[model samples]
Target chain A: MTTDDWVAIWLTAKLATLTTVLLLGLGTPLAWWLARTDSFWSRCVGALVTMPLVLPPTVLGFYLLLLMGSQGPVGQFTTWLGLGLLPFTFTGLLIASVIYSLPFTVQPLQQAFRAIGARPLEVAATLRASPYDTFFSVVLPLARPGLITAAVMSFAHTVGEFGVVLMIGGNIPGQTRVISVLLYDRVEALEYTQAHYLAAGMLVFSFVVLLGLHLLNRERRV
Target chain B: MKNLTLLAMPLLMTLAPNVHAAEVQLAVAANFAVPMQKIVAAFEQSTGHKVLLSSGATGKFYAQISQGAPFEVLLAADDETPRRLVQDGQAVAASQFTYAQGRLALWSAKQGVVDNAGAVLKTASFKHLAIANPKVAPYGVAATEAMIAMGVYSSMLPKLVQGESIAQAYQFVSTGNAELGFVALSQVYEHGRMRSGSGWVVPAQLHTPIKQDAVLLVRGRDNPAASALLGYLKTDAARAVMASYGYVH
Candidate 1:
């Protein structure tokens, strides 16, 4: 691959890494609340958080563009905070990917949290353990597999995302042109050989991540 | 079982014309939306045949047509696509003609953002400058050409935001993500005047003529309606509509 090709790969990895990190940090609390809470409003909020999984990524991006444009409320808020508008930039792309891939992260974490059961936390509470102590000491350790799955899923999904990235990122090389967008550009330009190479690379990368997760799960089951 | 028969009766009635009904599919480019919408209406009014239209980027449409989508007519953003379609036997030979010439403009929804000379790009007042992807969209190619001619390609490269098509490029500026973007002039025109947005119409000398072309695909050769629309595009009435929308003869 050329230097430009490597640049795309690097940017894709960076974007995926940042998106996964942000999703994990933000998703844990929300996923916990959804898993533990029984309120009707909590379920509604949970549904809204997972809404992106059902939306076509391009449609989601279209809405996001309006929400994150200069005149949009979110954009105005960001601008007031000195971050500028949130479309057509690398940072903007991260925000879009995080929202787009939220369910991939949150769903897995929620399932994991639920699997841990409330019995452990309740027992810890009886033993005079604080909520924070029980969470860090008991809950988090048990939910490691779920967190890993969520992170890997989020990262991989972010890397593979095309429609939303194209809609919001604008595919500027060395800035916002991630690997998937570059692959699309190659195909559109009739550079089939380059497209094939990039596509194959992505296929292998995604397979490796998924295979690792499945192997871990198998070992745990064993 | 009595209710089942009642439902089957209407289903059978609809399926009775299986041999007589034929659908003519047309793959249209995004920029040809207005003119093609009119032509389709007129053609259907005169011929009494349905035209199923699917509009998208010309590059994607070309890829689909090459893969043997059942599209009978292709209204393309550039002449090259129709020529390629004909050469590949996806389209009828000698059935292609330049239907309209497209115009490109640097537009901004923000007041006074785009001047007539387009000097704003050089100063880099805009944090993002949207344009269609030059490798795929014809309007993008023109936008790049205009940027190159104006000596802003390098300086603006860092701020460049490339859309898959002119439609999305317009969306970028219209949504105010980027201060301005290169768009089809037709997108910003209404009734012989430019819309509320500021625009700098790029000089023709900056780029190759965007000669939009229409071709009857291989499947369309036998469809009378498809042929009629292709012919209708050249008529005075159609030409006037195209002209009003900033298309050249």
Candidate 2:
């Protein structure tokens, strides 16, 4: 691969890593609330969080573009904060990735949290354990497998993202051009050899990641 | 029951001919979408054939065609792709011809952002300048050539944002995501003038000609409808539609 290809690979890795980290941070509490809450509002919020799952990525990207454009409300707020516009920048791409991959992170964590049930928390409460202490000490350890799955899934999804990035990121090299966009550009430029190489690399990477996840899950089950 | 069956037989026979109407799948470049829509309508009305247009970047269509996409014809924004397909034997060598000449323009949603001579490009006052990806869209290549000929490509490189197609490049400028962008004149031209925004039509001398070409794919070699549509594209009615959109035939 050329230096430009390496740059694209590095950028893709960075975008995936940052998006996974942010999703974990944001999805954790949201999943907790979703798992424990029984109110109608919780269901509404849950549905809202899962909307991206059903919506076409391009449609989501188009609205996001408008929302983060110069005339859009988010753009105005960012401009006020001296961040200019968010459509073509790395930070903008990160924000989009986090939203696009939210369900991938949240759903798995929610299932894990729900599987914990109420018995463990009740026992901890009887032991005079604080809610915060119980969560960090007991619940977190039990949710390890789910957390791993969530992290890996979100990371893989972010790495493979294309439509949203293309719509919002504008394919700026070294800034917004991730591996998928780079692969697309290679194909468009009729560099079939380069495109094939990148496509093969992605296929292998995705397989390895999914295989690892399945193995981990099997071990947890056993 | 025999009497009813006899009455329905003539109706069924008359409707049977409509089922034989040929469908031609056309892969059109994004820049030609506006004019192509009208041309397709006119062709359908006159010839009784259905035209299904899939518009996108010419490079993307070329890639798709190379991968064995089931398109009957390609209306491309550049001559090279059609010529390449012909040379590769994917398209009939004899059926490839220039359909239209695309005009490039520097456009901005806000008025007066682009001057008549496109001096604003030299000023470099905009924060972001959008253009179609040069590797994929011919107008993007022309835009780059124009900038290079104007001696500002190097300086303008940092501020550039590349869209995947001309349609998306127009989106960036129309939505104010970029201060100005390079798009096909057909996108902003209407009624012999620019419909919205300020624009400067890039001179032809600055870049190589954007000769849009059409080709009959090998898959459509035996389809009469495909050949008919190709011929129809050269008709005066179709040429008028193209000319209205600022395309030179």
Candidate 3:
């Protein structure tokens, strides 16, 4: 592989890793609220969180460009805070990937939280344990499988991201040009050898990731 | 039963010899989209033919064409792609011709941001300067050549943001995401005036001419509507539409 291809690979890995970590941190509490609550507001928020799952990524990218443009409310706020606009930068891409992959993290984690039921909470309550302490000590450990799933799913989804990034990324080398974007560039430039190498690598890598996840899940079930 | 016959009537029309109107599948370059739309409208009106248009980067169209896409005609953003198709035996060598010559411009959404001389590039005041991907769009290659000719390419490289196509590069500038961008003059210019923004038309001497070529693909030889569209493009009426969009003869 060429150095540029390696750069794209490294960038994609970094973006996926950062997005996975951030989503896990943010999605856990939100997933918890959805799992524990039975209110109309919780349902409303849950629906909002899952919106990206159904909408096309181009729709998201289009609205995001408007929202982050100089005339946008977010843009005005960011400018006031001295951060400038957020279209072609790393921070902008991170914000986009996190939103795009939110459901991947929250859905799995939410299911795990719900599966835990109330019996464990009641047991901790009888022991006079605080809700915070019970969550860290009892709930988190029990939800390990869900946490792993959430992390893996989000990582994979972010790695596979293309459309939204294409819209906002500007395709700058060593900046917004991730592996998927690089692969697309290769194909367009008629560099078939480079394109084939990247495509084949992605095929193998994706299969390995899914196979590993499947085996891990099967082991847990057994 | 009545509606089924109504639908079948349209299908039967293709079998009738008197009706020459047939569908022509077209793959058009993104930069020439506006002019092509107007041309297609007139061509369809005159010939009663249905033109199914698919527009994107020329590089992508070349890839799809090589893979034996069912496109009857290709309107490319650069001359090279059509010539390559002819050399590869995918298109008729005699059917290829220059349809439009493109002009590059440094444009800004805000007034006065881009001076007529395009002095903004040397100062390095802008955070981002959008340009189409040099790997794909011919306008992108022109922009790079101009920047290099002006001796600002090295310093300007850090601020460059490569849009997937000229259209997207225009979007970045029009939306004020990038303070300025290099785009086709047709994007910012209309009939005898600037459309909405300020632009400096880059001098032609700095870069080679952007000769956009149209070709009838091998799959299009049997399709009368396909060749008809190519002939229609050379008409005075079609030339007028292209001229209005800042494309040269």
In the range A1-222, model 1's lDDT, one tens digit per residue, is 888799999999999999999999999999999999989999899999989989888799888899999889999999999999988778889988888999999999999999999799999999999999999999999999999899999999999998988888887887789998898888877788989989999889989999999999899889
Q: Give the C-alpha interface root-mean-square deviation per candidate.
A: 1.0, 0.8, 0.7
Quantify all predictions' global Cα lDDT against the true fold.
0.87, 0.92, 0.92
lDDT of 3 by residue, A88-204 (tens): 988999999999999999999999999999999999999999999999998999899899989998999999999999988999878899999999999999999999998999899
Candidate closer to the true structure by TM-score (higher is better), 2 or 3: 3
Worst lDDT 10-window in candidate 3 chain A: A69-78
RMSD of 1: 7.5
Error of 2 at A60 (Å): 1.0
Model 2 CAPRI rating: medium
Per-residue error at B179 for model 2, in Å?
1.4
lDDT of each residue in B1-249, candidate 1, tens digit only: 999999898776566435334457888888778667886776665445678998878998888788888889988999999999889889987899988999998899977888999888878577988888889999999998988888888998878888888888988999999899899998887677778779888888899999988899998899876786778788887887888888997
Model 2, span A1-222: residue lDDT tens: 888789999999999999999999999999999999989999999999999889999998999999998899999899999999998899999999999999999999999999999999999999999999999998989999999999999999999999999899888889999999999999989998999888999999999999999999999889
Model 1 docking grade: medium
How far is each candidate from the true structure, as Cα RMSD in Å? 7.5, 5.5, 5.5
lDDT tens digits, residue span B1-249, model 3: 999989998677555434788999999988888888989998887778889999889999999999989999999999999999999999999999999899999999998788899998888578999999999989899999999999999998989999989999998988889999999998888995678878899998989999999999999999999999999999999999999988998
Instruction: Output the number of the DockQ-best candidate.
Output: 3
